[model samples]
Target: MPAKKNTADKKISKTVKKDIPQLYSPLLKTYFSDLTSANMIYTKIVRSPITKGRIKSLTLEDIPEGYFLFTAADFGEENYVETLDIQTEILASSEIYYKGQPIALLAGPVFTDLLDLEKNIKMEFEKDPASKIKEKEYPYAQRFIRNGKAQKPEEFTKLFSKKNYDIKGTWTSVLNAPSCNEANGAFCTFDKNILTISTPTQWPKHLQENIKRIFNLKTEEVFIRKTISSGPHTNTIWQNTVIAVMASLVAIKTGKTAQLVLSREEHFEYLIKKSPISIKIRSAVKKDGIIEAVQVLIELDSGYHNPFAAEILDRLVIAANNIYSVRNIEIIAKAYESYTPPVSFNIECIDSQAFFAIENQMQKICNVTGFLPDELRMKNFERKFSLPFTFTNEKVREAFSAIEKMYDVNRKFISYRMESKNRKIDIKNLHNFPLRGIGVACGFNGIGYFGSNIFACNQKMEATLESDGTLEIHALQPSASTLEVWKNTAAQILEIDPKQIKLNSIFDINEDLSVPENVYANVSVMTYLLKKCCQDIQSKRFRKPLPITSTKGFTSAQKKVWNKEKFSGSPFFLSSFGAVVLELEINPYTYKIYIKNVKAVLNAGKIGIPKIAENSVKLSIQHALTELVVDENLHCDQISVSFVQSDNDPTQIDGLISRILPAAFTSALSQATGHEINTIPVKPQHFFKEMISNENSVYSK
Candidate 1:
């Protein structure tokens, strides 16, 4: 096959500008310029100073009798939110689980009136020492194991004992800072039973359900419209949903439009921040660097109740083995209830621990056996594609090969080590305050819910024939995915030019269409699935078999089958793989790290939109970088929780570098660094410091 021409080398024609409006100005403005109202005011509970306490007596004075107020009591007995049958109570009822738990919510007419009401409210509590889940006393939850028809609390000490090798180290990364924005009040109004609520929410469907249940209204009675979200990564999930529900409750009860806009301080305090996880790993490895057995214990200081703690822990265990052939792996993950708010940090925290353990262990085995890291990894790497496996061996090999070729990883490794040795001997200058050192790390995370999880969307695309023969594509969100699926599908069906098709705005909620928890993994796969379905429907409709405008639901039973031991192989229909090689220059004296450059490659099947796919990979890198470098921490009751601080801002859409098209297979970081990294947001400063402090570090071993 001939070499593909670079996108930059392609010649541009004047007709290209006239043909591609979507490539330029794609955002279509609507009548609703602004969704927020000025009348509503919002404030969160100024939590009690104590951690563990029971509400004894509560009193409120000098407030109008009819002013809207709500607490956990308002949810009633029937209202509940369930993910994979695990029900998570939205509001804290009688007893507060953590110090910053949402006890009650207040919303009303004037901002001053709400503040005055808050000052008058008083509560008395009885301290309970037994209720607190202290870190020092009880670090983990009681574990039960089924042994020959008997269930017993498993001993943690024995389960996690090191048999052949052991390593102890602490890994840390800075949470990217968050940007500050003017506080805007969220308002909802019920006009003729059409309840329209606007807020910054990522999971629109979940928020809609919670609000419907709170107001005791049918699904059609409520409408959730999302505002232009500021943060796309982790900011818009659980916390925002809860606030929107509270505000809607106030509006519905008073028979008038109610608004709840929180101040920036209140947003910071009440909102749940990411939990910092501390991990300890022990492993059994052979002389050849192949892992035999592994034991890991992860401690999550979940501020309050964590809904995704169990799932996150499970993923960490699965990821601990890395992309190696291993047997007899044992993982024990625990979530400790703390006085701080519930923690939902990025997936990188777990990746950091797992990668640190695996990569370090690999290096150790190589050093002991006098083998290169790459050779050891390749020897143990899985090389076959089969079912009933989480990841195919072929896919892994392809990714590694692609990355190695793109970056010339083997040469870089030799160069980096030689440079480090030379720097150590010829350091005479006092002006260079900080010594520069480079480190590398790698990470992988699943996007959608795993196993038997289901997500559905009621997507509708309409097309009208025009006399001028030019097609106009109207879609909910215009991009390559929507264009190919909706407009192109319509064009093919009607036997008209794809440019002549028009798409209408998306505005429908089908109760049948739902997404299971952990929808991120499904983003890329679902796009393809939806597009395929559209093509199938278009082809069938063009044959005069039936109308394409019909509702559809998709469910996969693969995860359940695999979990039950009835099947082996991938539980998902498709999987996306990405690898990154970061060259980090760390200032040893100041503990500061500079990312010299990053080379990343991703494989996600056939590229639908080359530009969009490349952008996604770049965005992922930026997201990981911020989480590793930016510092955002919350200190409460001596324990600290972190947030995505403002400095870790997302990569601007305008300043994107080159978007590389995927080859037959994606590349691996080893090709660039000569060392395999298996962690997310790999902090060079932390890794280098640990390497320097511990002479028996993985790099030296």
Candidate 2:
């Protein structure tokens, strides 16, 4: 059900009805999927069939007059687009990096005609003698921040050697591929060495730069406009560039307009996956249950090549424990390249999996020390282990307390914990027991603007007061839902009617950003930046001339506060805290898990549009639920979300639900099954294997 603005209605409920997407999205038809012209031609790529290899030999047939065939030879050897500083060939010239690497393009007026030509293109490959997977890890990051300065790994080594650690567990997660409804493609036409293309992308400036480097075109020569796309930002960040470049290549060489869109299967197959991570944590705790010394290992499988490996590894280490005081801690995180699809950050950022690993580790602490889940969490939640490492957690205790009282969390957990213990005592006849468990986890998300490409895209905002007293704003067009919110904000700030505000779509400035709508993670930051611009215009409306243009910079305060090198300081743009109480029950006969109820309390700051914010959080929770406990039979009876009423300023909230829900869901399932269930997407086969291997497994591994 779509949320109403009443606080009383925000309670737990059952559901089998799927959430419906907003019916109308402008981006779905911006370039218009119906785009077609008689002068347009379709292109099909000839791909390498092997995972790793070199092109040993090739043969080709003659192309008809209207059809065109091109290869790497058509472009120079130096032609390639580098994503995140890693160079990838536009078309595989000598060696293939992965299976389905494009080797050639065949274009024709008819799409079916091109398919026939691809069959006649003969190709031979020599498989690599060496293995594709390597034991080495690249771009490694290690940090041990303790006592106000960076410490060495040996400090934790000495502590662990003395048998002082009280809690230990290993958690691994696999990122499930997100579902996309619309296919991504581009329409391109290169005339007189100037290329004009319409496509959607997360990083527009990067795409322009890629085109300039490959085609040797000037900055002003390439013109980019938005197109039809509802895909995830993880793919659009780099994937759109590949399609645009291919279509442009065909258009320039054939002297015909070209439209290229990946088929649905191709889009999903080639799309980037979040790096699957395995986190191992060991902690030393006092008799009263305060964590003092800790050691963490993060084994991240960075599929193909990720430019942000260092950032991913660093964020994982920092989020090992949320808002806790760990006096002596050491972190070792290594990223290894693999043969699967490349890994990219999720729409919520890359911290979801890391938060899952640590929160579960915290639950492990609860089981051994006999401290209630919330008791251990709130006791040491606010204390800082070190000044440099302690980022602000806005309402860590408040959110948890709200959900605890709203859902009667303590009483239910005590009951479930007792039931879990009873089942293990009667472990031989587990089928007779009604398996039920509840999990509680608290975490915060603080992704800095620098963490995403919004800043690197050279994002700038402008507002002009027209001579007719109507305000005109030049900015990146936001999503349909947020567009109205932007207008209302500007109108209120200037005391002008919402009808008088005009938003101009920015395209191809050649120096700054023109990102596709909602591609960036932090919508609140974008709105905040726009709010600042409107405020400035409101301040100068009387003193300045009839029309004043504000070309001012809109960089966030985080750039000054964050230190990316040291991996400390206030690296997050703003922090939003959340606590989830998730209940799960298992079917004794089928071995399938279903969500019973979920109660979440969030300190999301002041919500701009309560309905939109509520719907967005619910959708994020649903997506994250698919990541951990996907089942056709799985239906959540209640997923209650309530905002903290204390904060005055608005913080980022839309994507934070996904960043925190997986941890709570996984923790709940682990307790319910009474095994070391530290994996994701809990399949039926996995449950059988887990039970068969460790029928005697307990919480204290």
Q: Pick the candidate with the highest lDDT.
A: 2
Residues 385-449, candidate 1: write the lDDT tens digits: 22123653235455556656665665665565555444444433212543332222333443333
Model 1, 419: alpha-carbon shift in Å?
Answer: 5.2
Worst 10 residues of 1 by lDDT: 657-666
Error (Å) of candidate 2 at residue 185 is 2.7
* lDDT for each candidate structure: 0.46, 0.69
Error of 2 at 219 (Å): 3.9
> For every model shown, what is its TM-score relative to the native structure?
0.70, 0.88
Write model 2 residue lDDT over 1-701, tens digit each, in one string: 11111111111122222332211112334653467777998878777888887887665657666777667766675557777677767787878767777887778889898888788777877898545554573433334444423265565556654444467888878765555556777888865555677776656667788887777666656666666555554556676787788888787776778888777767766664454588888888777777777777788766666656666666776677667776666677788776655665554466777788888888888877778888988777767445445566766777767776788878877888887887767665677855788888877777444454333423466788899988887766667777787788888898989999988764435434544345342466666667788888878888888787776453555466766666667666667777888888887667777788877788867777887877777777776676665454355757777888754557777656766777787778778877666876566677667665555565335
Residue 33 miss distance in model 1 (angstroms): 12
